[model samples]
Target: MATPTQVPGWIAVDWGTSNLRVWALDDRANILAETQSPLGMNAIAGDEKLSFEGVLISLIDAWLPSDARGVPVVICGMAGARQGWLEAPYCDVPARPSDLAQGAVQPNVRDPRILVSILPGLCQRDDADVMRGEETQLVGFMDAHPGFAGWVCLPGTHSKWARVSNGEISGFRTYMSGEVFALLSQNSILRHSVKEGWDDGAFADAVRAAKVQPASFLHSLFTVRARALVARDGAAVAPGGAVLSGTVIGAEIADVLGLLQPGEEIALIGAGKLASLYQAALGVHGHKATPMDGTAITLAGLTQAYHTLKTASERI
Candidate 1:
């Protein structure tokens, strides 16, 4: 067995649909190096024997110190699944810190000394949807806000509104707002109609329109192009751009925020663009929003899972 000093360092990875992000951290959790690859789960589709071990080894080989080839590594996100290298089963709703830590680790076929653990996704019965990677964000949130208690909004392609009480994820819901927006803006007829640049003024105006008439999201989305062409004299050529941005985001906030009572704390997770948009919308509805770095949260999540596993191994 490699001595503690000889173990090199821990590796944290957030392997998702579109990209594979890897971080090399010292024992202190400070990042020493990082790398990314386009070998996302989505890109590997159609291949019957997609070898995650091969992808990981290739990435790690470039970064790993020659002497620390045996260092243990931990991974989160889609890497743990029936489609992934090994299935890390879903932890049920209202998952506790202990519950989150109780996941299985599978060794890579290419390297046995390279211990790997995959974080389990979340499943809730309140909705038909499921979340694979957002749970790590939640773990990261809990780690940052040790005693933080309240609800958090993780905005993304599939936005998740999670309720946490006393450091445990008590419940949550998922909205297909991002997916819907993508489909409408890129795949649907609205693709040809909208302008390319972002107009804050236009976006805000569209938000106001959605707020006043919630039911018009779908109907009003098409009007973006029409409004730009006929009403604004092509000034709003990016009609779909502003309209889709406002309608989908505004409508989602209106629908999800309804679950909260007066003065409920809301935390926003993800990149600045998406989180800032949600922050603006929440502000409009009289809610104060706190922003957390999505990447930081993901790293913290990996740390949490690692610590949990360490603790469990000690107990066993």
Candidate 2:
């Protein structure tokens, strides 16, 4: 909760497919308070009873200023999608992240105390790829590591691998490794074999095998089950999940390796188990990944946008 003395200078939001996270920040962009909801764009879009403004007000009403002056509410992610609050058009690649705030679109709202702006996502025409929330995180990372030029990997359901030169994102590629893994482990035949528990050795081995014989990825996936059934080994049965994970992740990395420069640095932006997994997996290929926290990067990005927009408005 934010006390009166800690009145937020503005609000930062990361509204994604399945989650909505909000943060109250002071003039210096320090977080005062934060909250989240499962009612993301997908949920709100499917339910007629839910309205974007209504949901936002419900979550942040208490944080709104008592004065008439409106507080800026800077949002990133799917909230700017075509089906979101209002379409914040895509900013094409070779675009600077700090400049994304200039493309932000404001939606009409009944609230007098809140002025909202949704940041535009990044897009590539030739490759026909797009990203929403992840761009903001990249902005934050680039801000922290100025002059960085290399590959930046954001691992998720639809993992993104982007190339940064100077300070602009030249291009990127997406992989559905996470989503595919989920379907295979939960909805596909592998569900029966996949179990809870992790075997570092099994995972590493699967990664190496995938790298060596990338063409066999499809067939190797089935081995997660076959190895469990025939071998009856504790390592195979208990860590089937790890093996499956490694297989897909390894395949993703193997494909992405072609895009990397011979000795270029890789920035792995994420946190928790997923980031750790990627760090280790990349390590297997003898490429050390520099890890960064996803949340912090996102907040830094939103903060960056807020300041950029604010400064522009102030100049006018």
TM-score of each candidate? 0.87, 0.93
- Of the candidates shown, which would achieve the greatest lDDT relative to the real structure? 2
RMSD of 2: 2.0
Q: State the lDDT of candidate 1 residue by residue for 1-316, as single tens digits.
A: 1122323368888989878898777777877777888887766654656568777777776556455445657788788767776788888887876686686556556674467877788878766556788888898888888776667899888889988878789888888899998888888877886547777766777767777888877788778666655865435254468667988888888777667765557888877788888887777677778677898998898888877777776789
Residue 101, candidate 2: alpha-carbon lDDT: 84
What's the number of clashes in each of the models?
A: 3, 0
Candidate 2: segments with Cα more than 4 A from true spot: 1-4, 229-238
CA RMSD for every model? 3.6, 2.0
Alpha-carbon deviation at 8 in model 2, angstroms: 1.8
- Give the alpha carbon lDDT tens digit for every residue of 1-316 in model 2: 4443556799999999999999988998877888999999999999999999999988888876667458899999999999999999999998897668899999999888899999999999998999999999989998899878888999999999989878888899999999999999999999987767889988898888888998998899999988867874555354889899999999999988867886667899988889889999999989888678899999999999999999999999
- What's the lDDT for all of these models? 0.76, 0.89
Q: Stretches of candidate 1 above 4 Å error?
A: 1-7, 48-50, 62-70, 228-240
